[model samples]
Target chain A: MDKRFWVLLGLFLLMTAAGLLLGEARFVFANASLICLSCIGIQ
Target chain B: MAFFARFTDALARLRRAPVQLTSTLLWNSYFLAPWLKNVPCPGFNCYSCPLAITACPIGTLQHFIIIRRVPLYLLGVLGLIGTLFGRTACGWTCPFGFLQDLLYKVPLPKWRVSNRWAPARYVIFALLVVIIPFIALEPWFCKLCPAGALEAGLPMIALQADLRELTGLLFAVKMVILALFLLWMMVTSRPFCRFVCPLGTIYGPFNRLSGMRLHFEESRCQHCDLCRHVCPTGLYPPEEIDTAGCIRCMECLKACPHGALQSCATGTSCTERSHA
Candidate 1:
C-alpha cells in the first residue's frame, strides 16, 4: 500500500531467494531432524 | 447499549477461541506424526517437544550461529510473517502465549509492572538470543527459557524413560525458571511476552510497518480508561497501539465504549471514511 511496505516486501523476497540459492535450505532441512536439546537446555 | 457491548465482547472471545485452538493443534502436531517437522514455526514452539510439528526459530537461529552458518531460511520466514502481521502471531498463535492466558484466568490476585521496564525484552533479545549464542556457541537463552522447559523438556522427560535419567543441574534450573514463570502468569497476564520473549522482540519493531494495524479515532472523545483496564498486558491502548508491546489481542476494541477503536488492514484509519 505504502512505499515503505513495498520496499520491505521487496527486500524480504530478495533475501528469501538468496537464501534458497545459497543452499541454506538444505542446512535447515538437515538440522531439523535433531531435537533441539539446547532449546530445552538439556545439552 | 450494555447488552450490545456485552454481545460484542462475547463475539470477540468466540472469534479468538477458534484461532487459538487451531494454532495450538498446528503447533502440537504430534497427531500429524512428523508431517511438518522440517518447517520452522514462526512462534516459540520448542522443537524438542514430542508433539511439535515445526522447529523453533530461535533454536534454529542458535543452531546456525553455532555452526557458523547464516540462518537464511529462518530469517526469511520470520521476516515474511513480521512484515505481514507483526506480533499478531504471538497474541493469537503461540501455544505458550495461550498457556499464559489460561494461567491468568486462575482466580488469583493480579499485579501490574511499570511500563518503563518494557524495554527489558529487547535487552533479552540482544543478549541471550543473539550475543550469548554467538559467543557461547550454544543457545544460552534456551537454557533459561521457561517455554522450552514447559513444552519440550518436561514433556519429553515424562514420555521417555531415558530422558529422565539424563536429568541434572541444568534440567533443575530450567524447571525453576518455568515454575517462576507459571507463578508469575497467575499474578500477571502474558508476563513473558511483555518482558522476556526474544521472538516477541523480533516481531515488535514490525508493528509499525505491518499491513494489519489497530486504528484509533481521536474524535470520539471519552477517556474512560476502560481500554487500559481491559488490556491484559497493561498497555495504554491509544498511545501504544502500534508499539512493540502490543500483541494485537483487540481487547481494547471490545472495551471501547464509544466504538473508538477498530482493527484495519490498510494503513489508513477506516474511521476517516466511515464508522467501520
Candidate 2:
C-alpha cells in the first residue's frame, strides 16, 4: 500500500473514534427516525 | 479463442450477480427493522423508502450541516467505504444505480452523453448537497432528488392519504424530474450517476486510492473498442481506467480480448500475474 492509503485509513479511524466519543449514533438515530420530508419535498 | 473469451465473459457476469444481489438485498432490508435504521448506509438509499434498511448518508450529512453540527458518523462511514472500495458502492450497492441498470436493459436506442457533462456532478455535490443546505438550512438535494421522489415520496403518498393531500407543486416538480430521469435512463446509462449523484461526487475521488483498483497493461493493448462497447457508462477504459467516474464494475476486464485490463488490490499483482 502507498502512503495515501495509510493516511486515509488513519483519518477514517480517527473520525470513527471521534464519532463514537461524541455519541453521533444517537444523532444518526434521530435523523433516521422520521422520513426526511424535506428530502422528498413533501413538507 | 472466441469461445474461451465468451466463457470468461459469462463467468464474470455470473460472479458479479451474487455480489450485486447481496448488496441489493442488504440495502433494501427494511424488514430487518429498527436496529438497522440507526446505521447509515454508504451511498444514497433514501431513508424514506419503506424497504430501506438504513439511513441515507447524504440526507444525514444535510441534517447535520443544516443544524450546524458535525456529521462525524456519516463522514467516518463514508470515508471508510470510499477508501476501501471507492464508487464500487455506487456500482453494486445503490438501489438507484440498480434501477438505472435495469432501465438501460429496456432495448431502447442508447445514446452517449458527452463526457463534458461529467463535471456537473461535482457542481451538484457542492451546490445542492453542501452549499444550499448550509445556506438555506434544508436538505436541498433531497427536495429535488428523483431517488427520494421514487423511493420515498411516491410510495409514502400511495400508502398515506394525508401525504397525497399535501402533495402540490413541489411534488409535481419532483415527479416531473423523476419522469425525465426515467426517460433519460431508457436512452442513456446511469445519467444520474454521471451527472447528478452527490454521493458519487464524494466517493469518486477515492477510485485511485481505494484498496481495489483497475490495472491496465499498455503492452497488451489491441486497440479494439470492446471495452468501450461493454462499459455501461461508455467510458474509454484505457484513458479513464482508474478515474473517479469508474464504478469499478470490471466490465472492461471481461471485455478485454488482449488480457490487458484487470482488477486487483492496490500494490498487488495478483490479478495481473494470475490472469496474464
Candidate 3:
C-alpha cells in the first residue's frame, strides 16, 4: 500500500457517498429486485 | 492406495475452496435478504438468479448505462473493493469463477489462454457493457451474459411454462455463449475472467495500486515454475505478480515451496519487495 491506494480509497469513498446522496442505490434496487427480463435473455 | 493418494492430494491442494463455496452459498441465498438488492456484491453474479440476493455489479452498471444514469454507487463500491484487495474477489468470492475452478478440475489435459489476449477484456468492458448499452438503450451485455443465462434464463425457462413460451433467439444466443464458455473452461483456466469479464476489467487495473500485495522474495526464488503451474490465470508470478492480468488468486503464494511469495496488506511490511 502506498499513497496511491489511500488516494484512491478516499476518491471512491467520496464517489460512493455522492452516489448515495444522488439516490442511485434506489435505482439499483429497482432494477435488481425484479427479475430483469432482458437479463433473463427474454424478448 | 492410488485412490487414497489422489484424494489426499486433492484435499491438500485445495485453495480458497472454503471461502469460494461459502460465498457461492451466501450469494445464492436469496431468502437471506431480498432487500440487499440495492447493494452490489464484489463478484460477477447475475442479480436475476432465483437464489441471488444482491445486485450484479456488471449488470447494474449496464442498467445504469441504458437508463443514461451514472452508476456511481456501483462503481464506487467496486472501486473500494478493487483498491483494497484488487481482483481477489474474482478468485475467492465469484460464483462463476468457482464454476470455472470446478470445471478445470475434471480429469482432462489442460491448456492456457495466452497472456497477450488479456487486454481483450477491457474492450469487452468498453463496448459490450458500456458503449453499446448507452447507444442502443439496451443492456446488450445482459442480453447475452453467460452468467445471466446460467443463473436466470435456463432456470426461468425450465420452471415457468410462460417463460418457456417467451424464449426466443436471444435466449438461444445466450445459451450458446454459455455453452462455449463451459466447454472452454474445462480445457483451460478461467478463460472468462481472463478474456471476457467486465467486472474483472474494473478490478484488474487496481492490482498495481491496491492495499493488498504479493511480496516476491527474489533471494528465495529458484524459478521452479510452481507458482505459474498453480496459477489459474496462467501468470508467471515472478514477472507478472501484480499485472492487470492477475486475478490475485494467491495460488502462487500457496504453491511456492520456497515461500518466495508472501501476502502483505496495508499493515504488513512488504516495503522492500512488494509488487504493488
Which candidate gets the maximum TM-score versus the true structure?
A: 2
Please tell me which model should have the higher DockQ, number 2 or number 3.
3
Clashing pairs in 3: none
Tens digit per residue, CA lDDT, model 2, B55-127: 8888888989999988777798889888877887777777788888889899979888987899999888889
Name the regions of candidate 2 deviating beyond 4 angstroms. Answer: B1-14, B273-276
Error at B184, model 3, angstroms: 0.6
Error of 1 at B226 (Å): 1.5
Per-prediction DockQ comes to 0.51, 0.57, 0.60
> In order, what fnat does every candidate score?
0.55, 0.65, 0.83
State the lDDT of candidate 1 residue by residue for B1-276, as single tens digits. Answer: 233223323434456657777898888877775757656787778877778878788877887887888777678778888877778788788888888888999999888787788799889988888888889888898888898898888887888788788788899999988999999999998899999988988899988887666667787849999999888778888788868898877778867878677565544534321222
Each prediction's number of clashing residue pairs? 0, 1, 0
Those runs of model 3 whose alpha carbons end farther than 4 Å from true positions after fitting are B1-15, B266-268, B271-276
Q: Which number leads on DockQ?
A: 3
Worst 10 residues of 3 chain B by lDDT: B1-10
Ten contiguous residues minimizing lDDT sum, candidate 2 chain B: B1-10
Instruction: Please give the ranking of all candidate structures by DockQ, highest first, separated by commas.
Output: 3, 2, 1
